[model samples]
Target: MEFDLSWPVLWNGLFWPLIRLTFFISVGLLVGNLIESLQWTRYAAKLADPLARRARLGDISAASFTMAFFSGITANTMLSEAHEKGEISDRELILSNLFNSLPTYFLHLPTIFFIAAPFIGSAAAVYVGLTAFAAIIRTMAIVFSGKFLLPPIKEGCLPCRLDEMEKKRDTKSALQKTWARFKKRLPKVLYLTCPIYTLFFVFKQIGMFAWLQGFMSGSASFFTFLPPEALGIVVFHMAAEFTAGLAAAGAMISDTSLTQTQVILALMLGNVLSSPMRAFRHQFPYYAGIFRPRMAFKLILYNQVTRGLTIALVGTAYALLMT
Candidate 1:
């Protein structure tokens, strides 16, 4: 058996996508860190205070919600400390952590949007918007759960001292921190991205994607709503990092056969399917380090299940409206 490889095809597949994504990732991370360093997201917590009150989240949980916009670990740390001190019950801790989902999503929104836009173009807007919507849904669900499952709290929920944190912001410091973070993060992102893009390119050249689509045709009933090429996107999303899925989507976006709606829907579907495994792999250690191992697993399970269902519901609505 012989294999034919062309430099021009490989170059087009790999070079352009890598360069574009790298540029976007770098700019996105720098700007994102800068914005975060400026402490602008503190306002999110303020706006959420009313909801927090309605849900009867106490001072520590409210403070942690504010802190989550800056550092999830720090916010979670606060909850863990409170749990240790017996300031809050186990149910309240879990519910409060779940309620922070919106702030956490917004904290990462800039980076996610910028990184996605370069590859998926306008579809990024639709996809990110849907995910944002799903985050809102999850947060609302948590709020309702807290209201029903937990007892009412005292009248006073100590306001977060975000203003104190905001007063310390310095543009020079923000820039320096952004630069340092960009330097540390960009290389690692590219390290994963380059190899994945190259491998995806090779898979494309070998007609593996087509074969996989055909092979999975028997199972296509499950995804009758999506085109066969969409299986490639979902597979890449589940098997590799998000960039791999974006690379696959980027490659397919140019193909005249696939409509923009189909591509967007595919990305949404991939997100719904991939989030569980991704959350488990990435969030387990962080959660476990802060909470007990069993609690960490429970948190991960709940987060993924909530995220998946919300995204699936939102995606279904989108598919119905668009298609």
Candidate 2:
């Protein structure tokens, strides 16, 4: 079983995708930063304050939650600073981070949707929409928990310090801030994206994904709920980047045999299976840098567990109702 390891095959597969993904991701980041620099997210934060207050979180924690919509790093940093100052307890610190997850998911929503749209068409919307729904559910659960478990705050105003956030807003024009952010973020994005994308392309050209699809087919009894072709989507998802799954699902979209619901279920299942590893690999380091290693691990554990359960619940309900 020979495969094309030729330069042309490698170049064609890697070049165009890397270009498209880079462009879309850059635009997404720029949009996110512009919204932040322009203070557009302030309104969202204002609206979320009622929810934060109901959860009995103090102004500092609520402010961190607001910061999350634009930059999760900054938001977590705020929480870490507050924790260090004893402005909030350990439990509040963790709960605040978890509460911010909904916005955190949204920080990359544009990138994910734009990337998936080209590959999976309308199903991209469905898949992203479902994941966003799961994020909302998880956040709501955190809010409910906070309401019951955490004591009330006597802070004069929940959104008062929200005005303090304006001090950090960029003075430059939106376009200038967007360009600066693009320059700063693009290199880091490409550093990781280039090697990983090239390796996945090589794997695809070399039949790695095909072999996994065969394995999934052989193990079909276990995943009885999903269609056979849909197994390839799950395989690609688990094997490589989320785009790999979209690519597989995209290919399957043209096949008249499979329904859109089946493709969505496969995506949801792939997301459920793949999220834990991704969190541990990508999130742990960042969290550790901000908080202690122990704290970071706790946050990651809570995040992955809660995320998995909520997404699974949404998937199960979707399957029952739609399929």
What are the per-residue Cα lDDT tens digits for candidate 2 across 130-236? 99999999889988999888998766553455566657555667669667866875676566556656666667677876666455434434787787788778877
Q: Which regions of candidate 2 fall more than 4 Å away from where they truly are?
A: 1-47, 155-221
Q: For every model shown, what is its TM-score relative to the native structure?
A: 0.67, 0.69
Query: Candidate 1, residues 231-300: lDDT per residue as tens digits?
Result: 7777776556688888889889877557777777777777776676557644554455456768878888
The pairs that clash in candidate 2 are none
lDDT agreement with native, every candidate: 0.72, 0.75
Record all residue pairs in model 1 with backbone atoms less than 3 Å apart, i.e. clashing: none
lDDT of 2: 0.75
